[model samples]
Target: MVRRFGNGTATARAREEALGKLPSPRGRLPVIGHLHLLGSFPHVSLRDLAAQHGRDGLMLLRLGAVPTLVVSSPAAAQAVLRTHDHVFASRPHSPVTDILFYGSTDVAFCPYGHHWRQVKKIATTHLLTARKVRSYRHAREHEVRLVVAKLRRDAVGGDAVNMSDLLNAFANDVICHAVSGKSFRKQGHNKLFRELVEANSSLIGGFNLEDHFPALVKLDIIKRMVCAKARRVHKMWDDLLDSLIDHHASKPASERGGEDCDFIDVLLSVQQEYNLTKDHIKAQLTIMFEAGTDTSFIVLEYAMVRLMQSPHLMAKLQAEVRNTVPKEKDTVTEDDLTGLAYLKAVIKETLRLHMPAPLLVPHLSMAGCDVNGYTIPSETRVIVNSWALARDPSGWESAEEFVPERFLEGGSAAAVDYRGNDFLYLPFGAGRRICPGINFAIVTVEIMLANLMYHFDWKLPPRSGAGRWH
Candidate 1:
């Protein structure tokens, strides 16, 4: 029998043979190739370089010891994230994430393999399923009610609410209850959760000298700082997760029964089925709380900022939300969200403009592949510049503007969806590695937003003079 490519392997090989070397910036340095060119904002910097070096919107750069491919256009993104998705599904390894996220044992950063697949299977099927998320509706509604009460108090006091802080707290409360079965803030202790989030943010906010400069990898000062911080964060995070797990583990399996068990309880129940240990349970919980809470607040903050900037748009969404839910109803339920098309559009527009993770977490190629006629070597770090792709002029009209109307009926952007099918608008990303928590995230956001809009009228600080949202 003649051997043949089963699923596009032959086609990819042919394309790679036809196309030669990948496009890269010239004058790369000896050790820190192309690292000097990237400023603080790497997404914007890469976008600029792509304009000059990306022949087909794919540009290769050497960041110290790592060879990275930046995909700055929608077509290029499709080739990497969809056309050859399986080949590039694994995540890149970083010392920072390894320490902070338990050696990338968590679902978000774990490499693509048996372990990752198993964890993902358990999480998607049992932990984060739509039914599982729906079971937590009471927790969500209760948290949102608390948020509204706080905001109403501020409103009565005639004070300008710090919307970002308020939303962050709201997200934190919801995630805490859903994950560990209680709110740390409400307990007035164990604020370690919030501290961990801040530490992780600081460590991963941007590229550090150690990341790009292999020569500095052994520097004692850098190692000490990184290790010390990691140890501190790990200790606190571990203790908290351990206590939660132990608290649940102490209970008899029968007593911990039912669909309403918190995430910790559920993970413990299936520990033997999935062959999961306490460490594995902790890693997953850490990610769930960190990723869930942070992204929710970021998206909410941006949406509110955009709405405040455009009063007319705010009023329009608010009216839709208000009309959908009766005046007598205390809060909007998940059922009411289905009919609020405009509100959905507003959230979609917000994600397009301000994606929480602009690069959609860096992906590593498991094998060599061809993308848009460019040969990408195995283990190459791939970054899909979702920020640039979302604002590409070719795919979107007035892409820079905040226009929710584009997603309305009969508009050019109306047919496009953000569930990753349309590469031109992947806020959550595409392929097998797409964010599995999308449904959970969407429901959490929609319900909270529906209540926020239905209840109060928001305005900018008096005489602030339309300052920058950031």
Candidate 2:
């Protein structure tokens, strides 16, 4: 019979006794709890511990001074991502996300509540809507032209190109143009933007021990890196936003109020509606750029890498693109995306294999909650390892393999959607906090990947062994 715990019941006592009897951590070093066990890859270490402890088991680790619970199974993921999504929706406060997100003013890292909702709604309806995203088609085409030009140069020179860097530049240009009506190549290009983008991406991969353990935040070396990066990024971000605000202020009322509304315009409108301060507006812009830019770039990079590693998949994807998209077109139109199911599958497959925010930003339990029979205490920092869940053998057939066809007909694979409902495959996360830019991201990746494949046949550069680049 199943057991229940509450109110000092026998089941509660038994559960406590069992927990007490569990072996003490092997050892703990001063100021760094179980850091040795984490080695270099903390995620791998957590997975090993979870496997030993059984699915849904909790392994307490002191990330610095913070207590963290790493949940590694699909069932546990469901518990955290679904059953108690509200409790886990709020992001943990950390120096890295705090500074980078303009003190958590942005939607991605903001704590769940009225403030987050306000920002999220504006982002969804005004900035990231399908129609708004489509308006940026010119930006996509312009960036792709630059990418093709570079690739052509590489092809003619027989030089090995770092496909990752190429894609990064492409993503940067597209995002810059979409948000600011400019390109990375625009006047006043500097290293600050690059550093800021790199720092944000690295931070997502879990570099700051302070994030997991707040007590030791001041002593964290990673926090120092974050602080330095934040200073540079915040300056660039402020300048950009201030320029937009000033531009709007100087423009004629009709030009400012009508179809000329850009991301900055939407933010200004929201600022007026909510009576937000200038700092708040600046903070929101910082969030949009930080969250939207690198994540899309990383996804695109991983998609290309996976496609390169899997030739059959690449060929199949190319055939689908060629069949659906006309050759004379410079780029695949958004309308063309609907007919490219295989292309969608490839993107989904890449997301499955490489979730940009693998853990989906740690969610804190605002209040006590019951999940899969476990009475999770209030204030427990809940983590959902979407990476493990996506790769779980039980949830997916040949989960680790790069097989886009598994998503096609007659396949035994489970349904994997970016929409927030499916806990097992939430690349953009699940619940009300789901990323608003999912549609934009999907279309951008699809169009970019389609154009690349349609225009050129990719090959490992000559004299550079497989996977090597100049």
Highest lDDT among the candidates is held by which one?
Answer: 1
Clashes of each: 0, 1
Indicate which candidate wins on TM-score. Answer: 1
TM-score per candidate, in order?
0.92, 0.87
Candidate 2 deviant stretches above 4 angstroms: 1-30, 183-185, 189-192, 203-206, 216-229, 462-470
Cα lDDT tens digits, model 1, 1-470, are 11123247775665344323778888799877788888777888888889898878898888886778899988889888888988999998777777767888888889999989988987899889989999989888988898888888888878788987788877877788878775355555335676677677776775556666545658888777656766787788887778778877898988777877888888888899989878888889888887888778888988888898899999999999988799999888887889999998999999888888887788998876667766676667888889889889998999889999899998779999878899888888899888888888888888898898999988888775755321
Query: What is each predicted model's overall lDDT from 0 to 1?
Result: 0.82, 0.70
Q: Mind giving the per-residue lDDT tens digits that candidate 2 earns over 1-470?
A: 12234555665565445333332255667777667777565555666766765435455555565556677766667677776676778877867667666778787878888888888888887889888888887767777777888888888977677888778767766666666565235554323455566766766565665665665556657556547765665666677667766765566756644453567666666678876777777777666666666777888887877777677888988898898788788767667878888888888888888877776678877765666555555455666677777877877888778888777656565365778766678788777677888887777788788878888776654453434210
Ten-residue stretch with the least lDDT total in model 1: 1-10
